[model samples]
Every structure is written in C-alpha cells, then in structure tokens.
Target: MALWSGRFTASANEFTQRFGASLPVDKRMYKQDIAGSKAHATMLSEQGIISHDDAEKICTGLDDIEREITKGTFPFDINDEDIHMSIEKQLIARIGEAGARLHTGRSRNDQVICDTRLYLKSRISNVMRANYQFSRVLEKLAHEKQHVIIPGYTHMQHAQPVYLAHHLLAYVWMLSRDFKRLHHSYEAADCNPLGAAALAGTTYPLDRQRTTDLLGFSAVCENSLDAVSDRDFVLDTLYACSVSAMHLSRLAEELIMWSTQEFGFIELSDTFSTGSSIMPQKKNPDFAELVRGKTGRTVGNLVSLLVTMKALPLAYNKDLQEDKQGVFDSLDTIYDCLTCMAGMISSMTIHEDAMERQAYTGHLAATDVADYLVKKGMAFRDAHRIVGHLVLLCEQRGCALTDLSLADFKAQSSLFEENVMHELDIPSIVRARNSRGGTGDKALAYQFNVVKDVLHQQEELLNALTRSVS
Candidate 1:
C-alpha cells in the first residue's frame, strides 16, 4: 500500500505508478531527503512534538539508510512513489513507530521542495567551481597568447587587429557575468522552505528557525503558500545554466571555425579531436561541435520548465515534479560542457604562423590607413571614401595596402606620405589602440590586472562556497 493509501481502496495501476513516481529521478536526492528528515525530527523533538528517544531512533535510522544508499545496498522501489515515501516506508519498518512519527508536522509538498533547495545549494556550488576552473584555463591561455596578434572581425570581415589574449578575455568577461548569475542562483536556493508544511502553517509548535539553523539555510521562507509552491530558484538555476551554455556555444562555434583548413587559426590536439572512421586523414573538432549542439538542450530545459509552470495554480501541484529532471540535465550538461571547453581550450595549439599570415592579408590595415589620413587633417568622411577606393584598388592590383608605394598613396590625396605606410604595419596598428579596454598593450595590461584580481576573488569564493558540499 502507498503512504496515503488509508483513504483509498486500491493501489494505482502499475503504469500509472511508474508514470507518477519520482523516486527514479529524485533518488539522486536521497542524501538531501534524509538530511531534511533528520532536521525535521530534531526540531520535532526539541519542540516536544516527538520524544527525544523517538528523534534519536529516527536520526540513527536515517544515518543507516544513508550509508546503505551510498553503498548501493539500499532497495529502491518505484511504486513507493517518491524518495520521501520510499525512505519513510523503509524507515518505519526499520525503526518501528518512531520512523512513522517523523512526518508528523510535514507534508511531501514542503518536504520535496526543501530537499530540492538543499540539494541545489550544494550542486550550485559545484557548478560555480567548474565554471571558475574553466575561467582559470582561459586566464592561463590569455597569459600565454598575449602577444599573438590576430585579425579582429566584424560581419565576418576583418576590421582591425587584436591580440589573441584580448579575444580570449572577452569570453572570460562573459563568464564573469555568468558567475554572478550562478551565484544569484545559489542565493535563491539557500532559503529554508521546510516547515511550510503543505501550503499552511502547522498546528503543532514548530521551530522553523531551528530547522533553518540545523540545515544551514540562510533564512526561512516567510509565506507558507509561497514556500511550498515556489519554483523561482529552479528557474534561476536553469536561466543561469542556459546563459552560460550559450556563451560556451559561441566559443565552440569559433573553435569549429578556427580549426578548419580554410581558417587554420588553431589545431585541436588529437586528444580532444575525433577522426572519422572512413576518412583516414580527418581530425575533426567534434567535441566542440558537441558543445555547440548540446547548448540547444540546455536552453530547451529552461523553456520547458517555464512552459510547464505557466498555467499551474499552486500551493502544490504534480506539475512541480517536472522540475528536477530539467534542472538536473542542465546542471550535468553545463558541467560537462565546461569540462570539455576547458580541456579543448587548454590543449589546442595556436598556429602563430597561420594566424600571422592571415592577419597580414585581408586589407586588415584599411581602417588604420584611414586613421592615418584623418591625422593628416583630411575630413574623416573624405578619408573613409579615399580608403574605400584604395581598398578597391588593392583588390584590383592583387597587392596589399602596405605594398602600394607612396606614389599610389599621393595619387589618392597629397596628404598621404611615407608615414602613412607605418599604419599598414599590423603590430603598429594594434599598438596604437591604447584607449581603455582597447586591444593595445597598455590597455591589455590594465584589463589583465583587473581580470587577475577578479579571478583570484572567484577562486577564493569558490573555495568558501564548496567547503560544505564535498
């Protein structure tokens, strides 16, 4: 018989039982479920709702169940409905009446939500650490590739020159925002929802604060109805994972493009690459492609939950059971994606010759040359028009902007001179961009200093947040 079978004459059909059961999905939260029960039992005993001896038996019984579950020795049943009922039934059998009394002041409505918050509070810490570790990999790459100049692009055409470090640091900044979102997600999950007890306050003298303290929650959820029904924390986590995954997907798209023979900007190490079985010479950036492909599902997970929760009215609804799987899938996906991205970024070989070669071509210096004409007192619009014509002429001549002699320049406008050729030098062009946050050496040095301090703070925070999780 099910836990609530007293008023019912018969059990749910087998298929219905399987369909409704969350034990399979939520069995993963056993530690959290057990921890919630322990806190609840302790609070019950302290408030004289249960005898201290009964609380002792319940706590000891849960400790035993936790060990068995951890060791894979515990029997899990789907028809038991959910982790709460599965554990509680066996708990009663093992500890007799004391275990049955553990749920006196609670309902599965509040219990599952409490378990979820506790579970997410720990898991969010891990995701943050993984995200931080990935940032570390990017920071390391930024240092190593700081001087490597590459063509900066807009609209898939070269617009200027930028150091490779400058480009990689863009992703790091995006990830820093991701860290904030992830931290907000963690904060959302840190509130205690245990004693909301099925959408109404309990008649028993319940010390909700004691359970909050016992469970390490920062504060208690104030409204009983809102506490039992809220899925905002889950939504926040999903949103965070979705945004981070999107950032990784963008990077992954770049990796795929850069590793191609046409671009030849980078080479994936054989360890992170895959070979087609039939194409003996093929070494593909398949893992990066996978990262890009997997982003679809991460985003879908968030949308799925949003749609699921849209119409449900709610102190507690079965629709809420639809929450955990998406959150679980996205968390796992983001972690795996981050791991793959870190490995790929760290191991890939940067082809300096190839990047340098491409950087020099593609009329990359056209804008710099225009700036040179602008410095010579030409109207900026006129300079842009003349530079456009020069680019067209370079295309016709099949030569580069730097290849044109001063004669070719004097023909466009008398303001052009030998000094204008200096602008054609890619390194000079890159070095000249000394504005704040620009790709110039001084700008990058400043950016690096700030990012270095930020990364250090991220590491320190990660260490603090995850200390209790592992």
Candidate 2:
C-alpha cells in the first residue's frame, strides 16, 4: 500500500504509478534526502515533538538506509514514487512506529525543497571550484605565452597586433563574471525551507531555526507558501550554467579556428584530438567541437525551466517535478565541459612562428601608421584617409606598407619620416599603446597582477564556503 493511500478505496493504476514516479529522476538526490531526514529528526527531538528515543531510532534507521543504498544493497521500488517515499518506506519497515513519527511535523512539499537546497549548495561549490581551476589554467597559459604576438581582429579582419596573453585573459575575465553569477546562484540556494509543511506553518512546536543550523542553511525561508513553491534557486543555477556553457562554447570555437590548417595558431594535443578513419591526414578537434555543440542543450535546459514556471499558480504543482532532470543535466554538462576545456588549453602547443607570420600579413600596422601621423601635427581624420590611400597604394604595388620607401609614404602625407618605419615594426606597434588596459607590455603585467589578486580572493571565498558546509 502507498504511504498516502489511507483514504483511497482502490489502488492507483499501475501505469499511473509508474508514470508519476520520480524515483528515476530524483534518486540521485538520495544523500540529500537522508541528510534532511536526519536533521529533521534531530530538530523534532529537540523541540519535544517526538520522543528522544524515537528520534534516535529514526536517525539510526536512516543511517543504515543510507549505508545500504551506498553499498548497492538497498531495494529501490519504483512504486515508492520518489527518493523521499523510498527511504521513508524503508525506514518505517525497519523501525516500525518510531519511523512513522519522523514525518509528524513535515510535509513532502517542504521536505523536497529542503533536499534540493542541500543538494544544490554542494553542486554550486563544485562548479565554483571548477571555474577557479579553469581560470587558473588560463592565467598560467597567458603568462607562458605573454610575448607571443598575434593579429587582433574586428569583423573577422585583422585590426591590430596583440600579445597572445592579452587574448587569453579576455576569457579569464568572462569566466570571473561567470563565477560571480554562480556564486549568486549559491546564495539563492542557501536558505532552509523545512518547516513550511504543505505550504503552511505547522501547529506543532517546530523550531525551523534549529533545522536551519543543523543543515548549514544561512536562513529560514520567511514565507511558508513561497518557501514551498519557490524554484528561483534552480532557475538561477540553470542560468549560471547556461552563461558558463556559452563562454566555453566561445572559447571552443576559437580553439577550432586556431587548430585549422589555415589559421595554424595552435595545435591541439593528440590525446585531445581525433583522426578521421579514412582521412589519415585529418587531426580534428572533436572534443572542442563537442563542447561547442553541447552549449545548446545547457541553454535549452534553462529555457525549459523558465517555460515550466511561467504561469503556474502559487504553492506547488505537478509541473514543478519537471525541474530536477534539466538542472541536474545542465550542471553535469558544464562541469564536464570545464574539465575538458582546461585539459585542452593546458596541453595545446602554441605555434608562435605561425602566429607571427600571419600577424603581419594583413598590413596589421596600418593603425600605428595613422597614429604616427597623428603625433606629427597632421589632423587625425586626414591621417586616417592618408593611411587608407597608402594601404591602397601598397596593394596596387604588390608590396606591404613596411616595404614602401619614405618617399613613397611622403607622397601621401608630409608627416612621413624615417621614424615611420620603426612605427610599422610589429612589436613596436603592440608596445606603443601603454594605456592602463591596452595590450602593451606594462599593461599586461598590471593585468596579470590583477588576475592573480582576483584569483586569490576567489580561492578564499570558496574555502570559506567549504568550511561553512563542513
């Protein structure tokens, strides 16, 4: 007989029982469910709602059930409907009447949310750790490749010369924002919702604050109905995962382009690359492509939850059961993708010669040429036009701007001088822009220091959160 079948005259149809069961989707939260039950039992004993002896029996039975499940000896019945019912049914079977007292002041509505908050808190910590690890790899790669010059692009065309370190740090900053978003999600999931039984406060002398502390929650959810019904924490987690996956996809796309024969900027390690069966010459970035492709699924998971919660009326609904699978899937996806990305980045061989060869091919110093004229007393707009004509002149003459004579340059602007040749030098072009955030040597050094400081702070925050939970 089902736990809630006390008033039913007949059994539920087998198909309905199987279809309604969340055992498959939520069984992964067994640890969370058991942890919540233990806390609830302890709180109940403390509040005098259940005798201390019964509470001990309940806690002991729950501990045994957790061990059995962990050891693969627990019997999981689909008819039990969810992890809560599965464990509770086992608990009652083992401890008899004492186990029945475990549910005296709680409802599955609040109970489920409690378990979810506990589970998501740990998950958020894991993702934050992964983000920090990946960001560290990026910082290391940047410092190692700091002196390697590459062409910076706008609209898919070469625009300026920049150090490879500068390029990699852009993603580091994007990931730092992603870290903040995930942290916000963690905060959203840090509240306790255990006493909001069936969307109303129980009449029993239940102490929500006791459970809050027992479970390491930051606060008790203030309103009963909102506590039972709220899924914003799950949505926040999904949104963070979506944005992080998007950032990974962007990085993956760049890896794909860089590994291509035409770009030749980097060579993916053989362990991370795959070769075609028939085409022996093809070494493809299959993992990078897979991470890029999986971004759609993570984004879709966020949208799925948003649509599920769009118009549902207050306190709890069957529709809300659709929440866990997508969130679980998205969290797993992004963490795995982060691990793969960090590995690929850490192992890839940067081809500095190839990058330098391509860096100067598209008249990449044209802007520096214009700036050179700007410093000489020519109006900035006039310098821009003169450089444009000079680029045209080089194209017609089948040579580069650097190959042009001083006389060749003076024809366009009297500002042209011998120093113009030095201005066209690629490293000089990169170094001249010494503004605080520019891609100059000093600027990159400052940015590296900032990245280190931000990383140190993030590590401290993550350690503090870990200690709180511990």
Candidate 3:
C-alpha cells in the first residue's frame, strides 16, 4: 500500500509507480536519509512530540537500516518513490507503530531536502579536497619548471617571453577561486531545513534548533515555505562544478595542444595516454581530451537544473525531483576530472629544449627591441617604427635580429649600438621585466612566495572541511 493510500481508493498502476520513482537516483543518499531520521526522531522525543520509547524504536530501526544498506542487504524498491519513502516504509514494517510516529512533525517534502543538504555538505567537502590536492600538483610542477622560459601568447601569436611557472601559476589562481566558490556552496548547504513540514510549520511543538544541533547544521532554515521550496544549495554546487570544469577544460585544451608534435611542449605519461590501433607511433592525450569534452556535461547539468527551477511556483514541486541526478553526475564528473588532471600533470614529461627552441623562432624579443630604441632618447612611436623596419630587414635577409650586425642596424636607424646585441639576448629580455607581477626573476620569486602562502591557506581549509565531514 502507498503511504497516502487513505486519500486514494487504490494504488497507482505499476507503470506510474516505476515511472514516478526517484529511488534509482536517490538510493545513494541512504546514509544521509538515515542520519536525518535519527536526528529528527531525537528532536521529536526531546520536544515531547513523541514518546521516548517510540523515538528509541525509530532511531534503532534507522540504525539497523543504515547497516543493512552498508552491507548491501537493504531491499530498495522502485515503487518507494524516493529514499525517504524506502526508508520510512521499511521502518514502519520493522518497528510497527513507533516507525509511523517518526513522521509526526515532518513531511517528505522537508525530509528529502534535509537529506540532500546533509549529503551535499559531505560531497562538497570531498570536491574541495580534490581541488586542493590538484592545486598542490600544479604548484609543485611550477616550482620544478621555474626557470624554463617560453613565449607568452596573445591571439595565439607570441607576444613576449615568460617563465613556464608563470603560465602554470595562472591555472593555480583560477582554481583558488574555484575553491572559494565550492566553500560557498558548502556554506549554502550547511543550513538545516528539517522542521518545516511540507510548506508550513507543523502543529507539533517541533524544536528545529534541537534538530539542527543534532544534525550538526550551522543554521536552521527560517522560512517554512522557502525551506521546502529552495534548491539553491544544489544549484550553487552545480555552478561551482561548471566553473571548475571550465578551468580544467582550459588546461586540457592546452595540454592537448602542447602534446602535439608541432608544439612538443609536453608528453603525457603512458599511464594517462593511449595509442591508436593502426598507428604504431602515436601516444595520444586522450584523458586530457576527455576532461575537455566532459566539461560540456557539467555545464549542461547546470543548465538542466536552471531550466527546471526557472518557472516553478515552488514550495516543493514534483519538478524538483529533477534536481538530484544532474547534481550527482556533476559532482562525480568534477572529482574524476580533477583526479585525471593531477595524474596527467604529475607524470607528464616537460620538453624544455623544445619550448626554448620555439621561443627563439617567434622573434619574441621585438618588444624589448622597441623598448631598447625608446631608451636611447627616440620618441616611443618612432622607436616602434624603427624596430618594425628592423624586423622587416631581418625577414628580407632571412636572419634573426641577433644575426643583424651593428652596420645593418645602423642602416635602419642611427640609434643602433653594440649594446643592442645584449638587449636581443633571450635571457636578458626575460630578466629585464623586473616590474611587479612581470616575468622577471624578482617578480616571479615574489609570485612564488605568494603562491605558497595561498596553498597553505587552501590546505588549512581542506583540513577544516574534512574534519567537519567526519
């Protein structure tokens, strides 16, 4: 019999029972559902809404159910509708009337959301942990390759010279923001919403604060209507997942490009790579490409929920059941993507010689050449024009700026001097950028220190969140 069979003459058809169920998706939240029930039952007893004996029976039944689930002995039924129903129906069968009293002051509307919030708190903690670990991998990579100079690009054209650490550090800062966003999502999920029965307060003297404390929630959701209606916690996490996935996608794209024979900047580890069946010499960065490709699914999950929530007149609609599957998928997807990304980066080989060779081919020192002429008392525009002409002359002669002699430089502009040769040296150009946040030694050293400090903070946060999960 259905829980609400008193209101209906008979149960819905088997097709309706199976089609309307959320058990397949929400069964994974069994632990959270059991925890919520135990806490709610305790609160009900403390508030005198249920007898102490009944509360004990309910708590004992839920504990036994949790163990059954952990040991794969629990029978999950498609007609149960969701995890809340499956647990409740089983509890009623085991403890008789005591289990029926468990729902004295709450409804499945509020019950399911409470379970979801509890579940998200734990999952987001793990997501943030993986995020922190991956950030550490990138920081280690940057420190190892600190001195490797490569050409920085704008519009995919080399515009200046920079340290490889500078490039890797860019992704670190992006992930740092991702960590903060995930923390915000955790905070959003940390609120308690258990006592708001259905769309309004129950007649029973429900002690919401007691349940909040029992469940370890930081705050009790104050508005009864909003408590059952809100899905913002899920949306916040989905948004964070989308943003983090996008960051990983950007890194994946660069990895794919760098692994190509044309760039030769990096070689993915054999463990993280695969080869074609017919092509004997190919080692493809398939994992990186998959990370890039999976970003669309994460983004689509966010959009899927947004559309589900956009026009709903809420206080708990049937449409809200659409929330869990996508959020669960995104959570799983992001964690796997982060793990794969860390594995690829930690094991991949860096080809410094290739990076340096490509750096020399792009006339990467042209800006410094322009700055060189400017320093010699020529107007900046006139210096830029002179450097442009010098680049043209080098092109015509089929030579680099260093191959042009003082006589050849003087032919283009009288400002040419022997010191210009020193300016054209690749290392000098990189070292000359000593301004704050520039690619020079002093600036990068300072940046590395800041990165270390940021990483320390991230580690502390991950530890705190992990402790909270336990």
Worst 10 residues of 2 by lDDT: 411-420
With a 3 Å backbone cut-off (N, CA, C), the pairs that clash in candidate 2 are none
The clash number for model 1 is 0
Models ranked on TM-score: 2, 1, 3
Query: Could you tell me which residue pairs clash in candidate 3?
Result: none
List clash counts for every candidate, in order: 0, 0, 0
What TM value does model 3 have? 0.98
Evaluate model 3: give its lDDT. Answer: 0.91
Give one digit per residue, the lDDT tens place, for model 3 in 162-237: 8998899999999999999999999999999898999988888888998898888989999999999999989999
Question: How many Å off is the CA of 425 in candidate 3?
Answer: 1.3
Q: Top lDDT: which candidate number?
A: 2
TM-score of each: 0.98, 0.99, 0.98
Candidate 1: global Cα-lDDT?
Answer: 0.92
Model 1 C-alpha lDDT per residue in residues 246-271, reported as the tens digit of each score: 99999999999999999999999998
Give the per-residue lDDT digits (tens) of candidate 2, residues 1-470.
Answer: 89999999998889999988888999888999999999999999998888999999999999999999999999998688999999999999999999999998899999899988898899889999999999999999999999999999998898899999999999999999999999999999999999999988899988999999999999999999999999999999999999999999999999999999889999999989999999989999999999999999999999999999999999899898998999999999999999999999999999999999888888999988898888878888999999999999989998998899999998987778888899889998887677998999999999999999999999999999999988
* Candidate lDDT values, in order: 0.92, 0.93, 0.91
